[model samples]
Target: MKDFKVGHEIGKGKYGRVHLATNKSSGYIVALKILLKQELKHDKLLRQLEREVEIQGNLNHPNILKLYGYFQDEKRVVMILEWASLGTLYAQLKRQMRFVEKQASRYIAQIAKSLKYVHERHIVHRDLKPENLLIDKQGVLKLADFGWATYVQDFTKQVKLNISLKTNGYNTHNTHYSHFKYSSSLKTICGTLDYLAPEMVKRQSYNEKVDVWALGIICYELLVGVPPFESIGFPLTIQRIVLDEVMIPDYVSKEARDIIIMLLQKDPINRPSMEQVLNHPWIRMYNKSSPQNSTQTKLTKTIITNINYNNC
Candidate 1:
């Protein structure tokens, strides 16, 4: 941390600020996340930071940002991560009203693959949105921000380690499965309002299917230029999510509509698994060389042209 020279502030969050930093040791540029120790002492936020670092460290994929290292001093905790030069997917999408089907598919496919990997390991990324998806200089989409994630087994394991005391002031066998059950249920409500699953809005029991619902929202937004359930305000949006209200604009393609329908199912049990999603017709169309290459060429030109015009 001492060797690194912190540059301009890139982003800010409630808990901390992210700075573009140069690692003097390796001469590598990285996004350094610095959080104050007083902020972490809150217990809830500290646990979140630990979970994010732990999960991100374990995950290694081309579509996931790499974590370099972390150091903590008396005042702050610093985490170094791969610097994505091109900014966020949200910014890129905002610049271009909506992405063509081929362009959206490539990015969604990469995210689905990453989610599939994380889900298989029993990790549920409670937060997945365009803002959390970063674009590298090479135009690859990477899944970032694991601060809201949790391990399914870790909760159970922690419960087992703590025993309940008897009423007679003696140690007794813990019958606290109900406690863990409630705790697990609460975590589902920890996701963002715009991208939260139906079950998450209802504060009911859910699992990895929640991520699929968010991905579905991301896909819909990609196709139609706005989230299907989003309204003019946060309250209205929350109401729609809780009430299972969604609107699909006529401009959205049938292929995209079908995929969205399957993913946005009210019942988490009925939603398509990540693997099934990967092989879905809409996704399969993106894998073909002809369509993929053609779309990439068109998008690359469009992006370059827009950048040049803006520079002028």
Candidate 2:
């Protein structure tokens, strides 16, 4: 704490609050996320916290929020993070109601590229939504909050090795086994209820494809203002996700609709990979380099100017 000067609260979360701070030496500004030790222990989230640090610490991608470092005192754990000057995508979405096709496509493409990077590393981001996406001053979208993310190994390769072990008559009990170190699909039912994929709704094991499913939902929400499966309550929403088909409005271009349909497939096997999502026609069309930055910066500044800075 001595290395910096903390300012007024900038954001709040379940764990604690985020404050705008500055490095005393370099004068670098950062967002300081302070998680309460007592609250973390009471919620039995110590292991989750450790995993969050481990997973997010190693991640390096332009579209992903940077976790500079972390320090702890007796009662608080403070994480130094990249400052997102434009606030969250959720707030912008709330104010604008919905985004145009071009804007939505550009944002989606960035998300796909970032997710592709993380998937290549065998990590899955269980929770993905506008609330967890931050926008920087330059209008760059960043993925944040890796508390529910975890590493997953290829099931086929591990299964083949396990079969070899059995054939050699080596007692499996003699070998050390840990799901955290090695796993095929993850079965834990975590993440927001609204964005739950079909397999997740059914309480079945799911892979990184779950993030692709969420990408579809986010795309839909970005263009339509609300999630496709949103219903009166949790049960109805679960039913919609499991049994109902997505109905993209006719106003949405065919290419945009096609990408959304491809992503929201009920079966995980049917959904496109993150690479495919990035290469989708709709994404590739508006994802052009030159126009994206200038347009995004203008739109972001316009929207941000309307937001009440005091609350943020």
Candidate 3:
């Protein structure tokens, strides 16, 4: 492990850098995410790192990143994960301009299935966007980066608080007021602004539904080559999300628009659940018409080429 060859710096984030490394013993290529120990000293960041490992470890789906193992020295924490040779979905989309409806549907369905598993396990992946999704050489999508995810049980409890005070000269007696208690609201705004749900924009209490909203945005982007609510800046973007300002491009198929609208509903309660999304008419039709043979052939060739290249 100490003498492992680091080929290239594949990615970097707030926590640390990710490198393509080859394990000498097993002769396997792995994506190594290195986090700075100093940064992890902060309670909040440490919790996020721990949660990422926990959530990723629990997810066994093909659409989610596979966590192999982790190690820590005095300076850094190194996490070994599945290597997706093709790189991020964002780069792929950028290269292709946009994806066909059938392709988009297949990828989105896989992502929905991943989210369904996460939600069922009482974990919310607060940040899910193209940048966080990786495509392997096989063209399979793997959801990555769980820095903003949190356990549902840890966030579902309501807290009660009462305040008593005497205000001004007019108030001679103690006045007590009780704040209405709801589920523990996530306070940190840790996602890309463009994909945030309406409830998230308002800083309201949210759950797994937020991930649905993000998927909708991803769908829209895959169809229109950009997000549905693409604004000039953060303030304008937040304003648009808060105002429910969204439009389905004319080029987008009617079925795709319908799915997007359902997922991007202003009310989180009204948004389609992951199961409903999977069963949606648009998804069903797309799945039926998917070019399985073509996709499979391309994927096989790509994976074989990458593996052979690595061997060389």
Clashes of each: 0, 0, 0
Q: All candidates' lDDT scores?
A: 0.74, 0.79, 0.75
Give the root-mean-square deviation of each candidate in angstroms: 10.9, 10.7, 12.1
Greater TM-score among 2 and 3 belongs to 2
- lDDT (tens digit, per residue) of candidate 2 on 1-312: 877779989899777799998766556677889887667653247556666776787787778887766766556777778788899999999999999999999889888888999999999999999999999888889899998988788542211101001223332223232224547668999899888899998999999999999999999999999999999989999999999999999899999999999999999999998878877889889976622345443433443343222222
Query: What overall lDDT, based on C-alpha atoms, would model 1 receive against the true structure?
Result: 0.74
Query: In candidate 2, which residue pairs get closer than 3 Å at backbone N, Cα or C atoms, i.e. clash?
Result: none
**Candidate 3, superposed: residue stretches over 4 Å from native:** 154-184, 289-312
Instruction: Point out where model 2 deviates above 4 Å.
Output: 42-44, 154-179, 290-312
Provide the lowest-lDDT 10-residue window in model 3: 157-166
What TM-score quantifies how close candidate 2 is to the native fold? Answer: 0.84
Better of 1 and 3 by TM-score: 3
Q: Which one is best on TM-score?
A: 2
How do all the candidates rank in terms of TM-score, highest first?
A: 2, 3, 1
lDDT of 3 at 30: 74
Cα lDDT tens digits for candidate 1, 1-312: 576778999877778988997755445567888887666655466556756776786776667776655665446677777778888899999999999998998888988988998989888888899988988777777788888887765354222121122234443444342222213344447767889988877768778889999999999999888888887887788788877646788877787788888888878889999899888888888866312223333433343233221111
lDDT of 3 by residue, 87-184 (tens): 99899899999999988999898888789888898777888999999987777788898878876555332222111122232322232322222233
Better model by lDDT, 1 or 2? 2
